[model samples]
Target: MDYKYIEQLLERYWACETSLQEEQILRTFFQQQEVPEHLMAYKAIFDVQQEQAEATLGEEFDERILEMIEGDPVKAIPLRGGLRRRSFLRPLYQAAGLVALILTIGIAAQHSFDEEGQSQHTQFAQTDSLERPADEFVTVPETQEAAVTVEQDSINLTR
Candidate 1:
């Protein structure tokens, strides 16, 4: 085969106009040790690509990356700098929850006191229907004469 077509393809390859099939043809053409003296420049390009095609970052690379992560666990926390890094908010939330808990307990205690007061009022109403006057329950106002009776008796005894 005349290498004129191969030379044309090489020009196309350098110009980046060659398709994958054309590139593959070039690789096969360069794989032959016997090439015309003019095509020697292309051998290095194809040979480098062939060598790199077999190249790989092996398990040693994986081990190195693992070692790097284990050596500094702080760097492993991805994008932590952009996250909400405020420790203050944790304490603030705890304080707010504590305040809410205390308010709930206080409101419950207040409700209990109200219930006790209502029960006492109802008991007073039931007891009020008995022979004893509701005044005996100690909620009534004292008469002026009854109030002064003790004072007058004390004065009379003193006199």
Candidate 2:
């Protein structure tokens, strides 16, 4: 019949001045079957609010969710044996390989150059020795007869 109080409460609600109790009263008044024509427009809104307030999750729902969480746990990888140790030693192995390669190359180069050097040294000694005067060359004798001959030659040269 009279909607003066409802109209006043709605005005306060629109103005952001209604208390929680006043809002509850408004929601309860709208739940009636024969709502005033002008207020019928607001019934749908209050009904949805009431439905949402009454909706809730049961204990069985919570139990099922907990069981699912406990059923499939995250698995951790094992780092036993030499799996992790080998990772740290990987650089050491690489350095050792590098040193072995350098040494191999160095020794090969030295041997290759040393062969050429020996041939050059022998050629230079033969040619240069033959070009020098025989009197300037001193000879060492290994036998007694050769030593005596060398001494007699030196004595004759001194004379």
RMSD of candidate 1 to the true fold?
19.6
- Tens-digit lDDT string for candidate 1 (1-159): 698899899889989999999999999999989888877877988889999999888999999888878866656645454243443245554444444334333433443455554333333332332222222322222222222333343344346
RMSD of each: 19.6, 26.5
Model 2 steric clash pairs: none
Clashes by residue pair, model 1: none
Clashes of 1: 0
Error of 2 at 92 (Å): 25
Displacement of residue 37 (Cα, Å) in model 2 is 0.6
- Tell me how many clashing residue pairs each candidate has: 0, 0
lDDT by candidate, in order shown:
0.57, 0.57
TM-score of each: 0.48, 0.40
